[model samples]
Target: MYGLVDREALLAKVRAQMHDKRYRHTLGVAESARRLAERFGADPDKAELAGYLHDYCKCWPVEKMRDILVRHDMPRELLEGEKELWHAFAGAIVIQTELGVSDPEILQAVRYHTTGRPGMSLLEKVVCVADYIEPNRDFPGVEMIRALAEQDLDEALACALGGTIQHLIEKRKTVYPLTLLAYNDLVSRRDAQGGV
Candidate 1:
């Protein structure tokens, strides 16, 4: 559906939209997403595209993001919740309405990059895990997650989600419902598969 989307131009736009550090991270995510998609037998090109635009609205002002969120009629809870989550929600709308991206997979990949939902697609899983394990990212368990990502997408995502939840709990931060739902769904799937 998005055959007319210009990948290079979109990349350039994304690069221009972000600061140097964030742009570097975006590049790292795109490369990581491409590699993960290749490993998982998904479309590397689409993964790269999604990764590049996933944080398109990260640099936008809070006021502008709030406006976009209202314009799109996003979940009232999201609008009333953490300001940090606005980027992912607003980025998806901006990607479609402003950037002219029409593909559902790409949009979903951007939309759920922050608070992932249950039953994510391969592309969504690839983007989420790639964002967590991007080369520039250096967290406590990043290496382990990166290794897990190289081996198993589902396991990598489950670990990332679990880690995020644990960190939030440790810091006494709000746990978005979707994040908990995604973690539970991954755990359930793993249980069903008799894998750990």
Candidate 2:
């Protein structure tokens, strides 16, 4: 149960901080998160909050994000990796230090929104999957993920994670180890339960 977080003010801050296209994506993620929460029986309000704030630092200058990474002592390996990954890790720190969000669940959701970790909480899975399937994410296999999400959250997330890994491999891009760990955990869980 999260306390009051001033949704209106948070939305305005997100609107001001992000560009129009990013803001629209954030809104879509929020709506998708809410829907996923409802389907999975998570707290929709909290999921929406996490979605709205997930990209809080997406538009920040590279220098500022790098500074946050330095301040937070992010691994040098990650620092040398994709610039896009900075937003999730740095956004988690920024929301706590700047936006005064102290809720651990919300913080964890923001922290792991990009490279999901093993043993994710329900809320975390909801945010990650919602982000992947948010409307406007026009990638191959998105519709299958959307349909799978409706039927089973874990299976949908495993599929989404697998898709991400495949995409990264095809592009010869860096693959975050934590994502692999998460995918392995999800796949194991689904298999243990006889697949979802």
Which parts of model 2 have CA positions greater than 4 angstroms off? Answer: 1-5
Candidate 1: where are CA atoms >4 Å away?
1-6
Q: Lowest summed lDDT over 10 consecutive residues: which window, candidate 2? A: 1-10
In candidate 1 the C-alpha lDDT for residue 144 amounts to 89
Roughly what TM-score does model 2 have, to 2 decimal places?
0.95
lDDT tens digits, residue span 163-193, model 2: 9999999999998888999999999987898
lDDT of 2 at 133: 94
